[model samples]
Target: METRKSYFFVGVGGSGMMPLAMILAGRGDQVAGSDRALDSGALPAKFADLTAKSVALFPQDGSGISSADQIVVASAAVEATVPDIVAAEAVGAARLSRAELLSQLFNAGVLPIGVAGTSGKSTVTGMIGWILHACGRDPTVMNGAVMKNFVAPQAPFASALVGQGEAFVSEVDESDGSIALYHPKIAVLNNVSLDHKSLEELRALFGTFAGRAVTTVVNVGDAESAALAMSLPRDRLVTFAIDASADLRAENLLPEPFAIGFDLVKGGERHKVRLSVPGRHNVSNALAALGAVRAAGVPLAEAITAIAGFVGLKRRFELVGEAGGVAVIDDFGHNPDKIAATLETLHAFPGRLLVLFQPHGYGPLKVMRRELVAMFAERLAAGDVLVLPDPVYQGGTVNREVTSADIVAEIAATGAQAAHIADRAGAAAHLVALARPGDRIVVMGARDDTLSLLAGDMLGQLS
Candidate 1:
């Protein structure tokens, strides 16, 4: 009898790797992996979905990799010192980075739509996957977030969706320059901005991504994306924007705190669309999703109809429960631009905005500390609150000088109510204690997925 292929993911509970693991396991492969997060049960969420599927989760150990045929999957965060790497090497198993594995595996499939941008990549990826699934495309998506639209009470965070169709969709990350790896048949790049690298670096990576794909979806409101669109070959580009003149344009817009309702114009016809997901940025996300679906050969009308029902991903403006009439929201907005956008969206709603913004890492704070301070100063309304927990670091090189107190002092200079709580759990308690009816308490952070858990705990406490 032929030996079954064994797949072992080193950091299996990771947001990216978990979905990928689920997809492989759904394909009848012998999928098992190890994660310190799961071993310690520090993240019950990280392994919950896989466990429901009967995908065994093991501790980080050499025992998990006893054969040379085992295919090892790792993320950028996985270190050389991980026991699984040692085990895989001892058995001569093929080691692959999550990006390398995804790029190779995803590119081999049909209708791989790669969504890339400095921001909104994950959102657009989920949006495209949602629209496709709603329109009966049965898209198999690999995302970095738990898409709330796919989640059930049973499967609260359905990250990877196993579908019958050939469309294998995923968000492409340019932070590690892994965007170059996959040649998707359809590519949607929301916008180019400085996040991890310089503008020149972003342009080069995004520019190459546009050129390599069979058809590229570019956002024109952002000049960097426009420049990329201008560079694309005649048969390879489609443009979308809310305020810009493009093939896919959202017109007659009414932006609400709960949803942005607009008419999407495509192929000279206007189709009414309403996005349940809040934010003006989601308008751009919607445009990107529609553009990619069009590239996927879905009818403009069908895609628009399907897109109206997307509820958004978890922690992307997730409403954790209204306790004592105070609305607590959890959002993944670590970067300066994302933080600014989320605040701006929440500010539009009729309520007092209290933002508990946590930095995901010390390195990010050091790199973006100034911009983060400036953003809070600029967008925070009067009566708005800003809370900071120290940046989260999991054994990485980070500047010691950067701290939450540093940001608190800077935001205070702008006359905004900012404070550094130092501890996330304490920060949550502080926010909840201050909560009142008619106020929106937003917990914002990234990298450490536990922020969502913290948000839930805050909500549970409040209720």
Candidate 2:
């Protein structure tokens, strides 16, 4: 398998797929792929970077799969109907799911560290990667989001780092049951909640994930993760928490406008650690990182100090720009839990929020409509406004009964100011008109890459 030289990715522009493609290319593999966004020129910068790394780009047509020896890698979202799949079959190319390829690379020789959770997986994975790098571990890290610390002039899209060391760190997803494919030396479960699947399904997936690890690190503050800890042997399980007793505990919490400080306690030693990234949730993520790094044999104090220099991942409450004294923020907060966390962090500061939220997809919106409505109603202050565009449509038939209008109505009934604008352009206009000097205009959603561009446009208009 190490002699395999060529890889063709189906959705090369996707957040998850991009990092893997880059990693393989960095390792001197012949990487080539296609995506709808690439063909439409939606992400020219990303495509250009990939091309510079010697990874060829192609349209979704069958031309990319040239030889029978080339491996075709595709995400679970890519159906068999895609032209790339047809081409691969025609060429007799070996096919593999994205997760299958990742697991094969992860389980090979390297000491794999897998971060898994309903949320915070990307952030925690980036943090662990950064810590390991800072400690001179020279680990190869694959994350879904761009890690700002690793960004360089040549590598603007710094989502993956290819290192010649014994450590390999990556975030494993449980959404499509891919978490079962990984066998990590140290597995970190940040938190467990309802997002992609039912609670029962998540429990089984996450439980198996933790059980397979050599040393499992869990969050005691999260009810589900904490419950899973009970099944693991004490010698094999490590626990971290903010409010509950655990092997690693964070206390003396201090939350600033865009940063947070906390005291990390482990093994009767307390280290004062501060993060440039804001929110109490991040502190929990930091604790999880610390636990995982410590499990990997890094000294507690060294790992804590390395974490102090950690720059957070993009789109996790990323500040786009401040124009006319109004700040425009872009966030990947589509699910109810993630949305609530972002809102809570923003509310900790003084400014009123003018939130323009696009539901990630029609199906997720329908699945979590009531929870989403309740989150908006409970979190938004009286003067704060919540605007909604239609759920992001990606060419699938879904139940349209629980639309953005339904969510807005439910939120408005709870005495919060809310409106549904049908589309992003109208929502942007409404948000611009309502913006004030001290207000924050937050463009929040997921799945759609255009949300960041939309946020930038809003900032320009405000200016």
Candidate 3:
């Protein structure tokens, strides 16, 4: 279906919803959105970032949904009791799931590329966006995280690029099973792992999404990704890997958080690419993007140039500030794999490490508590410290048994430094007081954007 000339978003401040609203508004749609946070007179700073664009924000009350002609779009979190939903229903406005509306735009374009996986979707989106822009293709990129490269004075991050070129790249979501909606011209599968959903559910959704594409780019290093790639039509699959044989493989890779750079060996050709981001996981993210770009018909040499100029995304290993000889790092690492990756990277540098991790949700911890404890115990050295705050979501219906204390106890059982702070403010203050000079303080979590802000506040205390 073609996009309507006007749109109304139900939760505009969301990481996923904000960029999408900006993209549609950039396409010249009459766009407005409402959020409960705005209605209750509490607006997070993240929402303020959208003020630079032409889009309008309203309270979650029916005020934002006045017209029947305009399409209503909502994220998975939006409920039927919302005033906008009620208004749309009363006025006979068409309510579209965020994925439905997003997939429509993606399919409408002449060139549609999807980056999907449990992790690295946002990073891959940034990588591919940079590659296309550097090749002078000027592709439109829609991502969950803010791309540092696209930041302007007014719009510090996030963009809805209505480029002259036909290519459009986006990171697809699977948390609510929305990944099924997208059918890309080129599909990139990073790695399949447990997070918000089960692997079986992830596999089916990602497999179906990739199979519908004209060309599917996949990671051969991962078993689930490799299995998904093998199921696709051979002619349609372009494989990439840091290991195993494939169309593109990253060889001689070295990740440094301080330098944020790596060297890649592709097809007997060795070229070092500098990434302004930390961790080995990001190197893998770059390879996934490179694979998708090649599958989309970009030349090998030009792909190198695009990535070299690419800066990292916001809140994913983001370096907020340094003061009092302490460097504060903010990352969206909530899952086992991501936590392990972050800890492993920081260990490479010569400094004591301290983690202020707020688990994203109670449900995710219940699913992966064992893995979480095991990974942290294995990676963290004797001097490293880990602080935990209660899981971020408290206002909803969920299993009550799972808590940060449970995960903390498990990690502590393995002889690692771990603590559970009942309050966010106390946790931030404790980290500041405990931090020694030259210690790397990393604030890690998901679902809540406040973690980044808290990291900044911690930096202020250290300063």
Candidate 4:
């Protein structure tokens, strides 16, 4: 746990591992690691940024660990048979999961703000970080996605920011059940739904997370979140909502294609707030950010002003390009709730959608097969087109009983134009042929880093 010790990450290039690596390296730790992606030379720009910041890059061939004094960090997905894990075991180095290491750093002499939920964890974390940074708090932020406000020429991958302040803001994941590791000063629970686990299991994990925080920022609009808030002491709970009454609420809501304007009402004082990110879900996210910063002793008006300038995180309804009157958007929405929220935002505007959705993995597709079909069937319009490519393969043995074709078949039954293309290239070609001047082509998925690149390439073809 010493800042000056040597640390090696097993999957260093992953979204979760990269930011932690950068933060450790920035704090004068000797950070080095490797990934399967590194061996294949994928995401060159991200690896280059890490190397520039003094993080040693290595292949996944077990050469990164040479001594027993170095601590080896591995993500939850890293298997015991992996070379990095084996090497660390052979060298007698201390091994820690990514969440364990992050919890250690977060709990060390800093005011920790943990954002936990099934969705919108990264966005809320970024919003809180931006508000604190803009108000001169100089907070260090560790996020899973690149915050556009912190992106600079030298730091294209702005996932983590090392600042000289007392606050440490991070998004905690519940999928792997690591959210219980940290006792945060302020905990923000966005919502509870089915994503990585069953509903009952998620409730228990999130309830414990909310119970440990000094101040719990609960979204009252979500029923499960509201239920958790009711169990906490009155003084320890700070609530925000868009529908029901709460400590912070958004009234007179207005939703546009890429922006939303609303009145934030707190303590009978109304402040007009506008966000650059689209969707009603983002309005809920904004309220959670407001309550979090308020609990951290930031004035409500100052936090509201900073929220307006927040430019949102990458791949969260990111507009890649507009060519020939056709716009292509890149989004990281894989689960049913996330996908439904994105579709609702797009439908609010007046454009035919050409959706190309790739399932993140086979396991999730099988778990949420019925819900996925029902979502696409009910949400998609008559003239809209839904195209699906096979789930991104990451070298795993999975049951292939439920596939993309099943979802497509269900959607087509509901009178929507849907197709399942086997590869991304074929899906892109089909989208190019079907795209018209007034249509918006949305490329959506999760877990895969190349989806953003594919979105840009789709734009090029339209032009």
Q: Could you tell me the lDDT of residue 6 within candidate 4?
A: 95
Question: Which should have the higher TM-score, number 1 or number 2?
Answer: 2
- The lDDT values for all models are 0.84, 0.89, 0.82, 0.91
Looking at candidate 3, the ten consecutive residues that score lowest on lDDT are: 37-46
Per-residue CA lDDT of model 1 for 164-281, tens digit only, reads 8979999989878998898888888898876777788889998888888899999998888998888888678888888668988888878886788988787678778889988889
Cα displacement (angstroms), candidate 4, residue 85, comes to 1.9
**TM-scores, each model vs. reference:** 0.95, 0.97, 0.94, 0.98
Backbone clashes in model 1? 0
Question: Can you give the lDDT of residue 79 in candidate 3?
Answer: 66
- Candidate 3 regions with alpha-carbon error over 4 angstroms: 1-4, 40-49, 260-263
* Alpha carbon deviation, residue 66, candidate 1 (Å): 1.8
lDDT of 3 by residue, 153-233 (tens): 777656455566879999998888988888888988888988878888888998999999998888888889998887888
Better of 1 and 4 by TM-score: 4
Q: Each prediction's Cα RMSD?
A: 2.1, 1.4, 2.0, 1.2
The number of residue pairs in model 3 that clash at the backbone is 0
